[model samples]
Target: MSTVKKTVEVDVPVHTAYNQWTQFESFPKFMDGVEEVTQLDDRHNHWTTKIGGVQREFDTEIVDQLPDERITWRTVSGDTKQRGSVRFERVDDTHTRVELVMDVETSGPVEKVGDLIGSIDRRVKGDMERFKKYIEEHGTESGAWRGRIKPGDTSGPAL
Candidate 1:
């Protein structure tokens, strides 16, 4: 597995940042290589991505979530094996620090080479930068779901 971590400070309140993040369907707007994200429910999502002409589809479920604080998820089904979390921190009333940490498994030599060459890290960093620009320009979240889900619990109501 390869671990990548990145952070970006956006000119938006913590809640604003967190709320936008919860709207997983909007990720492709700013997240590079992400073709689409379908929020299957409040805690599950299906993702489509293409990088270097290779496309992948995956399903992931949120493992833990705390409104305006953090959201964590792990892959449930797919060839892409990974887990990650995004954290929101208040820098002030109008600024937020967003941190992302992910651990991914490489199933083939192409992916393994990309990981070793720091391509994954650079890609994530670019994603964070794009997110910062996106929120700063939009000035508000498109939508939000403030529901909470405890780790390992899947009985929560859908969005």
Candidate 2:
């Protein structure tokens, strides 16, 4: 497995950043290479992404989440294998630092080569940058899922 970490500071409050992030279905609007994200339920999702001209699909589950603090997830089924988390920190009332850490493994040649060449790192950095711009430019979240879920918890607050 290879690990990648990227951080971006957005000029938005922690809640604003965190709330925007919880709108999973909106990711593809700003996240490069992401084709779509379908929210199957409050705790499950389906993702479609393309890399190196190849398309892949995956199912992910939110393993844990804390409003305004963090969200963690792992792929439950698909062509992708990864576990990751996003953390939100209050830099100030008007600033928040968002960091992402992911450990990923691939079973395909394209992804393997990309991973070996540090493309994953760069891709993640780009994603964070785009997310920062999207949130900062919008000035408000499209929607929010403020529910909370702790580690090992499956069901979060009622949607």
> For residues 27-139, what per-residue lDDT tens digits would candidate 2 score against the true structure?
99888899999999888999999878999999999988889999999999987999999999999999999999999997788888989889899999999999999999999
Model 2: weakest 10-residue lDDT segment is 150-159
Instruction: Give each model's whole-structure lDDT.
Output: 0.92, 0.92
Q: Indicate which candidate wins on TM-score.
A: 1
Name model 2 segments beyond 4 Å from true.
Answer: 155-159
Regions more than 4 Å wrong, model 1: 157-159
Model 1, range 16-67, lDDT digits (tens) per residue?
9999999999999999899999999888999999986789999999999999
| Pairs of residues clashing in candidate 1 | none
